[model samples]
Target: DKKVVLITGCSSGIGLSLAVRLASDPNKTFKVYATMRNLAKKERLLESVKGLHKDTLDILQMDVTDRQSILDARDRVVEKRVDILVCNAGVGLMGPLELQSLDTMRQILEVNLFGTIQTIQAFLPEMKAQGQGRILVTGSTGGLHGLPFNEVYCASKFAIEGACESLAVLLQHFNIHVSLIECGPVNTDFLVNLQKVELGDTSLEQLDTHTLGLYEKYLQHCDSVFQNAAQDTEDIVKVFLDAIQSPSPLFRYFTSGVVPPLTQLKITQPDGSQCIRSMSKIIFSSEEK
Candidate 1:
């Protein structure tokens, strides 16, 4: 029996890569329902998954932020049963806290935090009845190690971490596996999606020079880090495969390189001050620090 795998946010990035990889599997182990918010944006996904076993893949419209959309997509799946559910649909928000609007923050929470919870809630009961399932969330290292100017984004991911942790223990009773893929900078459209609050924003008009200066430095630091260490979309897809195939999946899968040390700061130091100082230094020059 082919595992019925449903993934959200397949318009681009990790979601698209994972959907294509699984659908095109030579062994045809997975029957994939690759979903995105808009069907029009699915051209890239369509092109990429072409020539695969036709019956193995189906693209659907699902907006994680919209309850009705998710329900509609779920109903379309055969038997209303999902063997594997990947909550990969998320939006990114970045900028100075004050400069960011309340609406933007709420939208971020809506799409990234509540949106994920809603998707799981919609499908969890069926999994409970089936007595077996896997939930893989596309979490971020930002959830583990907070970064300057990314407070809103970090808040959303951190909440997800807590939710997934709580669910992991409870789901174990039903033989359901849950994992959070705590990825670092992946070379994806994610960066483009980040609301560069400082860029082309009239709101930054009132911010002081010192604050804007820090933002400029933050942007440069971010660029340098991503340029030097960002992983490919395929790299993350491989990790996703490992988690899906494992009989006993771990709770978290972090992208390789820089994240481990950063995420371990609290455990290693016990005091939060070291992590604070480290991030501060990275975001600002030594003199500014």
Candidate 2:
């Protein structure tokens, strides 16, 4: 039987690349379902692989926030069990924490965390019955560390990490694998789209006047750092492929070069207080100099 893989957020970035790669692999027989929130935006994605591998790729509509949509998509494949499930749909919300509304927080969590879980739940019964399947959730470096202006996005990723951790344990007995891919900033439209949000006058209102003044001075500096930290989306897609195919896959894989050292530092450091003290001194000293 040919293996079937389902991936969300297939319109761009890592998800797009993964769909193309899996469909192109001749050694393995696969049916790749590349799903997106809006199918209309996927024409370029479809065109990119038009003549290359026509039979393997199928574009489907899936919005993580909508239960009915997930069920409908599941119904299409309910008879054909999914060999690998990639929960990759996500969104980014950035700004001063106080300026972020409760609705924004809810929406992020709904899409990034709850949506992934719902997809898993929707597919898990069939996978469990088969006694074999792999589940991969796209987490983030932000999941492991908190960063400025990304509180809501980070919170949602953190929730994903925690949920997947428990899920891995719970599914161990069934021979169903669950892995979290903790990725870094990729070269994608994520950052560009994030900048387009209308912050309004309240963007500055959320901060203390003095803090806002300081932020204005450092905003350019921060943006420069973020722009330079970009990694190739294909690198993340490769990691996802390895996680799916490896005989003994890890429970979690970090795709960014910086994540390993950061993970080590978090473990070796005694507590959050010490880590904060160290980070504060480094950041302040650099600014002062």
Best by lDDT: 1
- Predicted structure 2: lDDT: 0.78
Per-residue C-alpha lDDT of model 2 across residues 1-289, encoded as one tens digit per residue? 6679999988888788888888888775778888988999898677767757767888889998898898888777743788899999888887667677788788888998889989998999999999989998888887887655677888988888888999899899889999988887788667655531333465676578755654544455446656886678888888887898899788888887345555566778857665555544433435442
Error of 2 at 49 (Å): 1.4
Q: TM-scores, in order shown?
A: 0.97, 0.90
Candidate 2: clashing residue pairs, number: 0
- Residue-pair clashes per candidate: 0, 0
Off by over 4 Å in 2: 195-202, 213-222, 257-259, 278-289
Instruction: Estimate candidate 1's alpha-carbon lDDT, on a 0 to 1 scale.
Output: 0.90
Worst 10 residues of 2 by lDDT: 280-289
